[model samples]
Every structure is written in C-alpha cells, then in structure tokens.
Target chain A: MLEWTRGQAVGEIDTPALILDIAAAERNIRAMADRLIHGSVRLRPHVKTHKCPLLAHKQMAAGAIGVTAAKLGEAEVMIRAGIPEVLVSTPIVGRTKIDRLLALSRHAIVLTVVDDVGAARAISDAATRVGQKIPVLVDVDVGQRRTGVLPGEPALALARQVATMPGLVLVGLQGYEGHLQHVQSRDEREAHWRASMEKLTDTADLIRGAGFPLDIVSTGGTGTSTFALEAPGITEIQPGSYVVMDDHYGTVQGVGFEQALFVLTTVVSRTRTTDVIVDAGMKALSSDSGPPRVRGIEGAQYVFAGDEHGRIEFADQGSNLRVGDRVLLVPSHCDTTINLHDHYHVIEDDRLVEVWPISARGRIR
Target chain B: MLEWTRGQAVGEIDTPALILDIAAAERNIRAMADRLIHGSVRLRPHVKTHKCPLLAHKQMAAGAIGVTAAKLGEAEVMIRAGIPEVLVSTPIVGRTKIDRLLALSRHAIVLTVVDDVGAARAISDAATRVGQKIPVLVDVDVGQRRTGVLPGEPALALARQVATMPGLVLVGLQGYEGHLQHVQSRDEREAHWRASMEKLTDTADLIRGAGFPLDIVSTGGTGTSTFALEAPGITEIQPGSYVVMDDHYGTVQGVGFEQALFVLTTVVSRTRTTDVIVDAGMKALSSDSGPPRVRGIEGAQYVFAGDEHGRIEFADQGSNLRVGDRVLLVPSHCDTTINLHDHYHVIEDDRLVEVWPISARGRIR
Candidate 1:
C-alpha cells in the first residue's frame, strides 16, 4: 500500500505518484460516449492505456459496448472484473498463450485477432483440446505493417481458412491505422483515416462475398475515433488514450479530450538557478515518445534527468520552485507511462478520493 | 508466482519472461572484480540495473565495498536483503521519503546524496527528529547537468552547510559523468571521463581545504569504470550495467562485459514471409535506447510491432520460424527493461535452475 491514504490533500500525497483527475476523466468518457451515440459505430475502449479494472468499468458504464485488450493477461483481468465482452486486439500465438485464450472463452465472450493461417490453426487446435469454440477477428494490414495480413486476398484467404477450421468462428476484421494516429495535421490524419477505413471496409466486403460471416469491423484509436465513427462499415471504435489524455495525444489537432492523468512529483533538488530536479523520471514516466509536459507551470520545460529524476528548466532566472514543492506532470505517452506505476491516486479537486490499483500492470505474459 | 518451477527446461517457461544466464552473469561479476582488484579505487556496484537482491549479493560476494541505489525504495529493499552498506545515489525530498530513509539507517550504514542546502537541512532535520546522525555526500554536476551542484564553489558551500548542521555528516562527494557512458568512441569517452574526474577531484580538494571532511570520491559507470579505477583521488567506482550488459551498452568499445540478461519470448504472429512477430515488445524490453537485438539468430532484425509484440524481420528468403518457437532478445536498455519484469528466470544452459524475484522492481519512489 502507498503511504498516503484517501481524504488526504493532494500536496500531502507522496512524491512520484500517479495522479488521476476523476472529473476530467469522467468528462472525457462522456465526451467519447456522446460522440458515438448516434453513429453506427459503438465504443469498445481499449484497456491497454489505463489497465485498470475500475476505469474499464467506468467506460462500460458510459455505454461502451465492450473493451479491447492487447494481451491475454489484460483479457483475463477484464474478465475477472466482470467485463463480459473483450476483444483481444493482438494475435495470440504459441501453445501457452493460445491455451490461455481458449480458457478465457469459459468466462467471457473472448475474441482474438489473427493474421497467420498457422496461428489460426494453433488457436483451433487449442480450442479443440478444451472443447470450446473461440471467436476470432482477421487482422488486416491497412497501412501499419506491424502485425496484420494484407487487406484484399490475404485477409480473405485467412478468413476462409478460419471458417474451415473447427472450434473457431470468423467473426470480424480488425484494421488498425496506428501510423495515422499521431499525424500533426488534422486534414492529413482525416485523409489517412478515411483511406484506411476504405481499405478495411473493402476487405470486409471481399471476405463476406466469399461466403464468410463477418459482422464487426473494429478499428480506430484515440486520434481517429471520430472519423471511424462516421465511416461506412467500422462497427466499433477502440480508443484507449481518450480517457487519460497525455501530452502526445493532446497535441493532435482538435482532439477535445482533457488531460486527466499526471505524475505528481516533488522538486527534490534545486541547485541551479535555471533548472530544478523533480523526483519523476523514466521510472515514473516513460520517455519513449518524449519528455513529459510539466502541467500548469508556465515557462517550464521538462527534461530527462535520469532514471529517477526529471530536470525542469525555467525560462526566468528566479523561478517559483523550491525543495519539496509538488508539481504535476502530463506524461508524453499514456500507455507506457501508466505501466510504470503501481497505483493511481484518484483526486477530486485538491483531495485524494481513492487509490486504485493498476490491476493489469506488469502482465506482459 | 510464475508458471514454471525450478529445474524445468527453458522451453517450459512462459513467453515474454526475463531470463538471466547465471554463468554469464557470474563471469561478468568476476570480470569487474578482477579489473578493480589492484587499483586504489574499490567497486560500489549500483543495484539499479538488476534490482535483484540475489544478484546484488552475488556481486558483494565476489568483491564489492557497498551498493548504490537510485531511490529510497531501492535502499529499503537492499537493507532488508542484509546488504551492509547502501548509498542512495539520488536526492530524496519530502517527509515521507526522509522518514523512510531515517528508518533505514537503524539497520545498515545508509548514505544519501544531496546538492542543495535545503535538502541537506531536510535530511538533517529528519535525522534529528529520529535522534540519529545521517551521512551525506555532496552531489556534483560534473557533466550530466541533471541533479547536482556546479562542482567547485556550489558543492563546497553545501558541504560546509552540511558540516554546520547537526545530525548530518558530510563525508564524501559524488560526481557522476553519465553523459560520457555511451559516446561510442573509446578515445572520446576516455577524454570526457578524465576531465570529469579531474573536476570532481578538484572539488573534493577545495572542500577539504575549506575545513570540511571529504573522504570518498565516488564516480564512474559501466563505460568509464576502467578510467575511474586509475584516476587520482577517486576512491570508488559505481558501475551498474556491467553485470547485465544490454545491446546499447554492448555497442560501447572496449567494454568486454558479456551479455547476461535476455527477454525470452515466443513467435506469436507471422503475417509477412520476411517478418515474424514475437511476444516481447516495449513492455517486455525497453525500446528507449533502440530496438532489442535478436540473440544468436543470424540475419534477423528486430522491429517494434506494438506494445505487446516485436516483429522480427529476416534477411534470408527462407526462414525456419513457426508458432511457439522460443527466441532470446537482448534488451536495448537494461535498467528500464529490468523494471518491467517481476522475476528473473535464472537459467544454466538449457536448464532452468532458479527463479529470483525482482525484489525492487517497481521501487521508483
């Protein structure tokens, strides 16, 4: 357990703590729900960003149809949290992970994505051993060439193979435009998002024309959720970072989500007149995207001090920082930054309301 | 607990696991000890890289004067592990961390680094409340420009203030040249290392001449330990990454440490004929430095697939990869990569010998 308890002041919480603004988070959740209310697409918010069961429940309460997870561990956590519908967004290969995915079918409507025929066969074999039938989505490579098959014939062939395989159901197609999520220009992002959706919808038509059952066309992230909602065939949008927007996602033009997640740190060392050192660093906030933004501290730029400290450089010679002064930092990447901490110090205004455990933290397997 | 037991085969362990080659780790430990035996400088290995008490004990058993930690949480874990001397290398501010640090002093010889007089006074005041005197070292900025005072007058002023404050003992100076650790060229790194040591030694002399007691002059890392061992007035070297050399550290010239740490993963998805996706991604192996290198697999390049997958691209046209095949990955950055895992699957060749818990895995505060 953490040192600070509920009902404590925000300044009284320990340094280098993960802080969550409940008001802002709820606002963001409501905003996403309202945006997709009248559209054909429904929300299946990804739990990979927050990895908290409580947050997943909040998303579900706000009218999310289901939740999307990147790993089997996350799916298991969501299942235990009583989240009935979970789409395992990443492909589950190998005997161990496939067996775990098969076991998850007993508790929830578990759907996994697959790009390879060999992986499809593996899942079918594992499900056959467990006497269960698993629902699978054909992962299509729209633009990002990371982990998906090509859209037209390749996806159709894999769906056809999955249809023939016993103990498996070819449900839908998952085409994620990950590369277009962070484009600086809104017009460019919209253009790329529309093109990727076109590719995904065309491939869905191709698979359905081949006498395969394909209902859900899941896609989009926080950056492209609005565009995906208005698309022709994307039935579900999976946007994770909208709930707790970070500095990186906040920079995307016209994304009206408020920054809700922060790393509360203390100014530990202030030897130089130009810069002060905070207790948060790579261990407290991930720097894979870039350095986090110091929230509400005007003329301050956060720099990577080391693994355990952050250097905040001020524009003025005489700064407002002193030793032990608390500061909030908006992480650059929400998904990786949330993985670094154990608990989220949930705050309402200036008071700590609760400490929620990051249930799926360190669940790499 | 992990899925596999001791003495199990390497193939039986779960995917995306942190594996430690015991033989290679012991050899790396002995290599550092042998290199510093005849020198005036002793080894005070930093436990931030591995963060495992069992590995720290192995280093101390070989030859280590003390252990250096980056946080008070790590110090607490080290103290519980029966490590006699622990020096916290980062400045700890606030009442919560100070109270914990003071409590740790009752069990072991504890030391902390401070750059500002305010932080020095905070530690002194906390120690006074507990009726125990605490030893502190003046942290000098040598070149990192992160958390340290500007070497000569600033460091001397803090040391003098610490000398006047009751319940605080100014015993040493800590000057780390962190920027010179991975300069790529051996000559350039050596030049920077020598200059930083000269600055630290000169600052130590100035503080001692000003009637302040300064004995230990701690400096060095995996890249500059050899140069630090022969530098004049430098009493100890704090190199953490030598025990578990990563891909980034392995690229440095003349650092002959064997790679001991590996993230064991399985091939999960294969969409392209040239690329196969593994289960270890940024969450399994830290990709802040670069993508991890695939070990022993010739003509293979590792690419970041997503948060939970790594796409391994093969140079050869025909590959032998299939679902469930295990692959070893050398992490790009060892410190952050080690923090992402909870256990280290200790292996001796093809056999799993032991499972060591990462006792200080998420001790970031």
Candidate 2:
C-alpha cells in the first residue's frame, strides 16, 4: 500500500503513516557508531526496535559487527535479506523451532541463548543428528529475574554443560540488564548498571576458570551503552533504540539521540472549541508506557479515544487547526509501536522518498 | 505460514498462534442472533473485533443486516470480499480517504459517520464530483467525549446541515456509550445506557421534526447488549466482541458469551521451580486493558516479560510445566489482540480445519 508513496510530496501521503526521517536516522546511526568505534566492545545493535533489514545494513556499515534479534522468525527475515551473522537473543525451545533453527544454521552463523539443561540437550541432539555445531551463549540473569540462570555457580554450570555437548560450542555469556534500561536518573542507572555488570563479569571469569571459552560477553542497550563503555569486560554491545529514539528513551537523563520516528496523523474532527480528534489511536500508536506527545503543535494533549481515533485537546485558541490538517507525534514506546505497522514511510528533505517494509513486524513465533 | 495447518492436528501448530474454536464461535453467533431475532433492533455487528471476512459472512448468515467497520480500509476489505453493505463507524477525513470512500461507494452501500460540518462538506463535495450519493450519519457524543457531536442541539444542527448538502443524505444518529460498556455493575450500566438512549432518541425526533429522515439510531456493544435490547428507539445494535469473548468481557457479570478465542503459546524456558517463560508477550497479546489469563493452566499468573516473551509464575506446583510445554491464554481485549496477528487458526473438534486471513488487521487508515 505504501509502495506508491515514492516520488510524492510528504503532505500528500496518507495519515496514520509510520514515518522515518532519513537524515535524522542516519545521524543517529552515526552517533551510536562513533560512541563505540574506539572501544574494545564491538557493536551488535538489536534488530527488534527497527524491524527493517535496510536499517540493519546501515548500522552494520556504520561499524556494527552483526545484528541481534529477539526471535527465530526475525532472524530468518534478516538472514533472508542477506545479513550474514545473527544472534537470536532469546532461548529457542520446542521441536519445530529447534528443527527450524538447525535448518537455519545451515545458511548462516546462528547463535542462541540457553538457561536450561534439558532444552540444551534437545538442541544438542538435534544438531548432532544434522551434523551442525550451533553456537550458544549461557544466558545469565543478573537481576531482572525474568529469564536466565542465576549468576556465579548456576551460570557456570549451564556453561559447563553447553561446552561438553558434542554439537554445540559455548562461545560467550549474555547477561542483559533490561530492567535498568529506563532508569530516570543517571546515578541510579549507572549504580545498578555497574552492579549488574560486576555479576556478569564475575560469572564470565568463573566459567573461564573452569577451562571454557567465554570470549564474547555481550550486553547493554540504548540507555546504558555509555556505562558499558566504562565497564572493562564486556566485549560487545547491543544498543537498539538509539537509532530511532522515542519519548520514553528521550526522558532518560543522558540519552542525547534525536527523535527520528513519528506517526503522521490527520485531524478528523474539530467538534468543540477545545477538543479535536485525530486518526491515530491505540492501534496506530502504543500506550504501554504513556501517551504520545504532539510534535509541532503547541499546548495540546493527546488521549486515546478508541482503536481508530485519538483526542487532542488544546489549551488556547483550540490549536488553530481545521479538519484534514496533519499532526506528527512521537510514540511512547518505539519497539511496540513499530511492531504494529507494515512499512515505514521514509522522509528525506521533507519529501517522501521510499517505503521500506518492516520485514519482521509480526514475527512473534 | 499457517496454510499448512489446514489439515494438521491442533497440537502441532506453532506457538503464539491465534485460535478460533469453530463450534464455540458458532454457538456464540447463534446465541446473539437468538437474543435479538424477535426484537425490532436488528444486528449489524461491528467487524473491528474479528477482522476476518469469513466471520463477517458468518454473522450475516445468522441474520445480521450488515457489518460495521471502524475504518475505510476495513470497509474496503469487507466490501471487496462480497459483503454488500457496510457502515464505517468513525469519521472519514482528508483528501485521499474521501477519494477512496467515493470509489468504494460505487461497489457497495457505504455509509460513514460525521460530527463536523466541514468534514461533511468535504465528503459531500467529493461525492458530488464523482456523481455519487453517499449516505452520512450524524455521530452524537452521548457521554463519551471521543469523536461525536454533542447530543441535543449540536447533533441536530449537523443533521440539518447534512440534509441540504448535495451528494449526501442525512440517514440517522449514532451514539455509542463507550464509557459505560465495561461497567462492572449491571444496574449502573443500564442506568447510563438508558440515559444515553433517551438523548439519542430525542435528537432523532428533533431532526425528523425539522423535515429530515432520521430513521436509524444505532448503538450497543457486547458489554451492554442486553440493556440495549430493553431500551426503545434504537433501530439496530452494533454489538461486537460477542462472537469471540475475552477476559475483559468475561469479568462483566451479565455478558454471557462463551470464550471462543485464545493464543496458543509454548514455554520457552523453565529455569526456576516457581517460574517459566512463554513465547507470547506484549507483541502476541494486547495489554491495554490488562494481562491475559493462562487457560487450562491453574494458579499461574501471566506477566509480559518483553516484546517476545511472557513470564508465568505458578502458586502451588509452579504450573507442573516443563520446557516446550504448551499453554493457552485468553487475551484481555479481543479487538486489539486480533489486530496483532495475520491469520486465525480455526479449530473444529480439536483439529485445525482452516486458516482465515485477517484481511483488515492493519487497516488503520
């Protein structure tokens, strides 16, 4: 549907369109690259935030070693688009998924995380039968307590089991502190960040002391990448949202990335003097964190009216907006909002230039 | 992806799949038809809950007059699928959308709602340019200050303006009491429902008294459908979410519809004795209302862990679950959850019978 938007002006495009500012996005990618170019830690930004392979290539060209994905289906999309090295950042379980993983391992170097022994043995058996050595990292739970083995003895135990398996290679440790990515204060964020990093590094040394290879200790995100640079042992970083920052990440104290993404909406109705309605609502924009801010419109507040409409109430002069007018808004959460649309309307020099399909938008399985 | 599941067993399907129970859904459709078959208010069930054209055809087969869509892109999908009548339940604004609406009116009897006189004029001018007479309805804001005009005088004023405009016919009024849809108490829901209905009917009479034909006064939803059946002067009810119930509707006392939809997920990690992680998370299930319920798994609470994983912790035996185990969950809100998937795996007698495309899942604009 968005393929025809190329060669058209920006304002002529349809409403409720996911827009990507090319210049700003390029600047953001370069900024992240410049942050890690001189460090010992290599870059492998997560692909979940921007589900586009073209953007992944941009990051790779800027200085990234590879890309990190959250699911097998997402990895498949990137690999099919010719991304060579991909690390699925989550554990891969079940029969069909394991079979798919083994099949995918034949095409590219695919590495996944593991926290349980039974699941690891299953993958080991499947890989041995297919004559493939799949690389794996021990997923250690520093503090989030969501998914991952506990640090110290527990993480080393999983690492030991992974190293002895015939068809698997234990290459590294993946300890991501997702819980500390959005801490409002820089001091509190770095304090928790250093604590989580200490646990991860101690576990990495413990596994290496037991005579296993733990070379690639990958971690970090947009809000804590600078802290990762300060840490000593992390060999790679996976900061995703810095490339297209949202309102949620912008509020963090030290995050200096410009907002490169927005939802272009249209004023559908102006019934009352103080209230107006737009075409973007909960279905168009995500609201898990909070409401979106009205960009380029002053003294206006946006609230979800329904699945298809958003209410924007103005404080003075009722925004001076009329029916069929356009408004831009920065979404609350970039990852979840990007997962809802099919493509991103690329804007360059205030003109519609390209439409890139979000190849892995609904790749939940 | 789901095409091969048409002849396979239900247990072998992939994780995070949206499922529709054929028997249970047919029973729900029949129950809703039986509820309003003897009354003057016919059914024009809203298709926003189930974006499937097959489900819309099933509703029509059960004696629904037409289908109500929330966007023009959705109405275009349903109309292209051979449904003869569609009523777009929201206001259609902007140039491209009005042109698309005029083009769609040539194929089906398309009716849209409008609250502002300027938008109505834009739609009328476009229809007249194409030599078409598009039906328009005055959307009345009964109590939900979302998208409609104010109830009494403002609604009548808009109706009068629409009556004299060329290429448009003033059909009726639509006042949906969305704020009272999920009221937990039946007495409170009915009290507010009756008051909203009185305002709508009074405005309908006022418009008709001014020599305008205000025949249709449509409103209702799954939460307050029985109360709408008791109210007078509501020509038809637009009760969606009845054919496939969710936990949001199940919490309401009097909405007695069977749960016909679920998301099938698999446990991806079981590191601890008390907690496990599933493949479904915020991307698989919508959490605007709340978290989804773990079906057929007792004493386990589901929390969104990330964009691609769910953390389910058990109270007693920790769900008696292992890695690669299957789990079923009822979504909190059906409409927003269905918009996340591409297709529905239809199960009849516990076997995958068909895979229907969600034709209008991303049809926001």
Candidate 3:
C-alpha cells in the first residue's frame, strides 16, 4: 500500500521530514514550461515558494526569465547558488539594507520595487554609492490594499521619481492582486482579477504617459496565473505556488499543477479507534491557511495536535493503522510550510531517492 | 528601550531579529520558580517556546525540575547542552525516531507520553531491545481534543498497558489543557480549567487506585499556569510562553509576562501621510495567531502586506515616523516566529549587546 519510497532505503529519514516527488515535480515543472513556451507572458516564478536554489535552477532551465525573492537574504542564497537573474520583490530601505542591496546589484542583475519617494531615494542613494544604475519598479495598489501607491497619480509620481534618479531605471510597474488569488469561486476570481487588471493597466498607462517607458507590467500568483497572464497590459506573471501545489491549491479548477510536495510524517500513535498522530503540525506546516488535507484519505480530518504533531482521523472506521506508518499530508500554504523545514526528501514511487537541502529555508532577513 | 545580553559582545545588531531580554527572562523564570516553590508542583517549561539551551539553563537555574521538548531533536539539543532531565512532550514514532529516543535515554532522564497501546508497545519493544526501562506517561484528552486518550476508562487502559510492559515504567499521566491557555475571557478560562482539572484529577485517582504509583502528573501552559497549579492532583505545570510573551499572551489576564521578545524591524518605506512598511512579515513573524501588534505605537494597525512585508498605518495626525526608524512588533505566536529565524540578538538600551544562536532553530526531526 505504501508507494512513495517503496524499494528505497527509508532507514535514515528522520520524523517530520518533507518529501518531494521527483516524478511529480518533473511533471509540474514541464507543465509550467509548456505554458511558458506557448504563452507570451515572461515566466518570473517567485522563489519564495520553494526557496531552494537547486529548484530555482530547475525553473530557470525550464525557460523562466528570472526568479523573484521576497527578502534580500533569500536573493543572496539564490545568487550564491549561481542563479542568473533575481529580483528582491520587496522594497529595499534603510541605509544598512540599502548598502546590502547595492552590493548585491554590483554582482547580479537585482531589481526591487518601491511605493514611495523615501524608499526610492534610499535605492537611488545606494545605487549611486555603488556607481551603478539599479532597475526599479513602482508598486501599484491594484486591489490588494497592502503596500504600493494608489494606481493613478501616486503611481505616476513614484515612476517619475525612479526615471529622474541619476542611478535608477524605471523598468516597469509591479502590482499583485493577492486578494483575488485565492477566490474560491471561478466567476468571483475572474471578476476580481478583471477589476484588479483594469487598475494595473491604467497605472501602466499613467507611468508610460509620464515620459517613462515601462518595460514590464508584473503581477499574479499560481492561483490566478492564467487570469493574470491574460490581463491587458501585463508582460510577466509571478506564480510561485504552482511549483509545489498544496491543499489550498488543490481546490483550484484546471490549474494543471500536481500535488508534488508533502510533509511525510510518521504515525506516532494508533489506538482509541483509528486515531493516528503524525509528526507534522503547525511547526512543520503552517495552519495560517487553516488545516491541511490528508492526501488520498477521504472523509478524514487532519486535526492539529501540538506545535509538532498532527492528529489524522482516518476515513475507514477503526482502520488497522499502526505506529511507524508514514503518511503524507498536503500543506495548506506551500511557501510557509517549505520555510519551516531545513531539507526536502526527493521521493519516487515510495522509495527514498535524494534529499535536497532547503538552502534558503529560513532566510527571513 | 532594550536591555540585557546573551553572551559578552556589544554592538549594533542587524535589524529585524528576535531579541531576548535576558534580565526580564530571568525574572519570569524566577517568578515561575517561586510560584512552584515549596510545593508538590515541579516546573518543566516547554522548550518549544524559546528553543534556546541558554534560556533553558536559566529555567533550570530558577528551579525547573526539567525541560519539555516538542521534538526529539530539541530534546537532543538540550541533553547535549548539559540539561540532564528532558521529556519529549510529543509522541515518538517511526523506527528511526524510536532508536534516537532510546539512544537519548541512555544519556539523560528521558520520558515520553503515549495515549495509545500501539505506541506503548513500540516504546516497550524499543526499550526492551536497549535493556532499559523508559518511563511513559499516559496522555489524557483533557478537553483539548487534539491527542491523548479520553480521561476515563480509555486512559486507564493505556496506563495498564504501560504497567504490563517490563521495559516501560508507567510513571504518571500528562493532560495538557491547551484550549484553556488561550481562552480570551478570564472567567471563561478559569471556569474551563476547573472543569478540565476535575476530569484530570478523577483520572489520576482512577489510575492510582488501579495499583500504579504515579510519580508525575503534568498539565498547564503560560496562560493557566497559576490555575493549573491549583488543580487538585497535578504535580507539575508546564508553562513556556511566560518567559517570552508574544502578543498572543497579552490576551491572558494577570499573566505578568512582559512582552520581552520583539522583532526589531526597520522602516523600509515611509509614505507622505506617514504610512510605513517594515522588513518583517509572515517569514519573520507568524500571523497564525493573528496579525502582530506594534509594541509602542498607539493607534496603529499593523496590517500584513505580504509574506515579506508588513504595513504600519499610523494615525495621520501623529506622522513623526520616517525611514530607518526601528519598530518592535510583538509576534502573534512567539514559538512559530522564533522557529523562522536562525539566530537571535540580545539587546540593551538601543544597541545590540549580544547574539544568542538558536542552536535548535530548525530541529524538525
């Protein structure tokens, strides 16, 4: 019945380990590559999902234009791993952080986004110190009212500031409609993306009218990659979760991404019915997206036992599961769950294959 | 204002790091020690909260009988660091994991709990093979409905199974009432604790009357430590969050645990209207227990911008903030937030005084 690591040496694997299906991952990688080949959109997958430079290279080989990292530390890890193009999707601020970012830009084609003049000045000053012109993107508040300037005049002003800077290039405008990514209903998600795209396209027009040539209009995640790529003026889409689909992504219709990633947990207990506690919990997989789903186990609820244990109530009444049994749990949020571990086990056909180090697993800074 | 150092060095620490106010930590350590002093209750703070052996030593110095770890790796870290007594609070399953647990018991006084006969049998077999008798605590459901046997005949049956094993010692029971720990209402929490205590006390008596001499009866966390100590038959209270109170702990009444741990993040961007963005977000501090609260900023909503950025919307009237200003964010859940980092900074009076390595930072195994 056990499949993922069937004939392989499962001897040295520690409990609460993350196992990746190499075959499934390959299928997922090829699926995205096929999409990139057919579509005109530049595939700049966000590295924040896997955070493994090795996996980042897999995406680059599959024809991704660049990789996007949420933090400078993550970008540093990718750069060290020899990934060609990288973007610190988040803004670089403060003299110390700016200095670090400038140092990175000297070696790599690093790009960053900013919403205000204060942040723009910090990036400009850092670039000037390094004697280089840094590429900058003006973040527009399309619909996700978090960071970024308002879509019209404010976005234009920020883009103009970047264009006027002595050591900065206003490459494009970046805006993410995060709220629309996880809309459960297809009609609702499409409607939400349409509204968000209207704002983003309008902001792109505004920046272009402000005497700046916007080379890129970047946005979107795995949940709405298709919808985002089809947007009027968007040139690139940042879809991270497609690399490692989770339970939340499992709900998406026709996404074509396989459930390649799983937290391979050991059954620690089996008594009092078919109750089994797995080694993965809130610590191994994030509960922020709510509880995880048990793979291939219908009518079973994965209840969190503690910080490091999850109680999976089996579907079959009083199932004969015992201690030491390894079960797979689909993570709710692939990005956060992957960040919690130090390594990943690449499994094929229930066999222990290879272990990939999550080099940028906890590069939070 | 920050105060205290972990080791000896003193300098400006890199921003956006978890800092332990060592002095305040010492005081919290002493307070828990004093409360359990001259009493039957032994203090065994859960190491999952801090994950620092240095802080674990501080707990032991303040009269903690032992430390409780959520994983075997954490227990190994503490045992290797010279802490003699440790209990793997979570269940240990899998042959590889059981081997590690058996190996650990050779060096330290290792104990673990099991709510299932299958787990107890596995432990018995492992212990038998090692020619050692490992202590096992019968875990009771205790109203949390996470793990553990129901506190009636079910728990008695598990205890009997433990007693039947020559290689296993049925030392006592562990009933962690986790749901009571975060009961927002004081009366509700106390009332819930009373109900849970009655059930646990009844179960403890039932096991004792069944001719088993129970050595330890542990329950409680930071929120209900005082109330748990008041429980009729509980011999120890396992409180961990008090030493480093997160924003989640602030909801508990009379907790007396100051917000000692803060994510010292610098302002990445400042809008004209004084809206600010910080370097830390989901990767830095978890939003599972909800969004983080700004430590000293009044009337500011700390909205989560993305996985790597947090937006602080300051009241437009008090717009004195600028880029480079550092703000401390009280994490929603300290345990998960601390796990997301590799190292912590110990600060004193606006300067990074020392650095404390989170040695067991990613001990998922």
Better of 2 and 3 by lDDT: 2
The complex in candidate 1 yields a DockQ of 0.73
Q: Where does candidate 1 stray beyond 4 Å?
A: none
**Model 2 alpha-carbon drift over 4 Å, by segment:** B2-9
Per-residue lDDT for A207-242 in model 3, tens only? 787678989888988878866546668889888888
Candidate with best DockQ: 2
TM-score of chain B of each: 0.98, 0.98, 0.95
Question: How well docked is model 3, in DockQ terms?
Answer: 0.52
Q: Give the higher-TM-score candidate: 2 or 3.
A: 2
Tens-digit lDDT string for candidate 1 (B1-365): 25777787887788899999989999999999999898888999999999988889999998898899998899889889899999999888888888888878999999989888877888898789879999889999998988889989888888888898898988899998999999889999998888888899999999999887787999899999868666989999899999989999888998889999999899876667888878888788887788999988898999987678888999995888886788998999999999999899999977899988999988988
Per-candidate DockQ versus the true complex? 0.73, 0.79, 0.52
Docking class of 3: medium
Q: Write the per-residue lDDT of candidate 1 for residues A127-245, one digit (tens) a residue.
A: 88778889989999899987789999988888888998887988999998988888978999999888888999999999889898788999989998867656888889899999999
lDDT of 2 by residue, A1-365 (tens): 33355677767779899999989999999998898877788999999999999999999899888899999989999999888899999989878888889988888889999999989999999999989898999998989877789999999888888888998999999999999999989999999999999999999999899899787998999999977677899999898999889999989999779999999999888878887889998889987878899997778889988788898988776468888888899999999999989989999988989888999999987
lDDT per residue, candidate 2, B1-365, as tens digits?
33344666766888889999989999999999999988898899999989989999999999999999999989989999999999999999888888899988989999989998989998899898889998988999888888889887888888888988998988888988888889988888888888888999998888888888877998999988987667788998898899999998999879989999999998888778888889998898988888999987668899989788899988876357888888899999999999999989999988888888999998998
| Candidate 2 local Cα displacement, residue B155, angstroms | 1.5
Which pairs of residues clash in candidate 1, taking residues 3 or more apart in a chain or in different chains? none
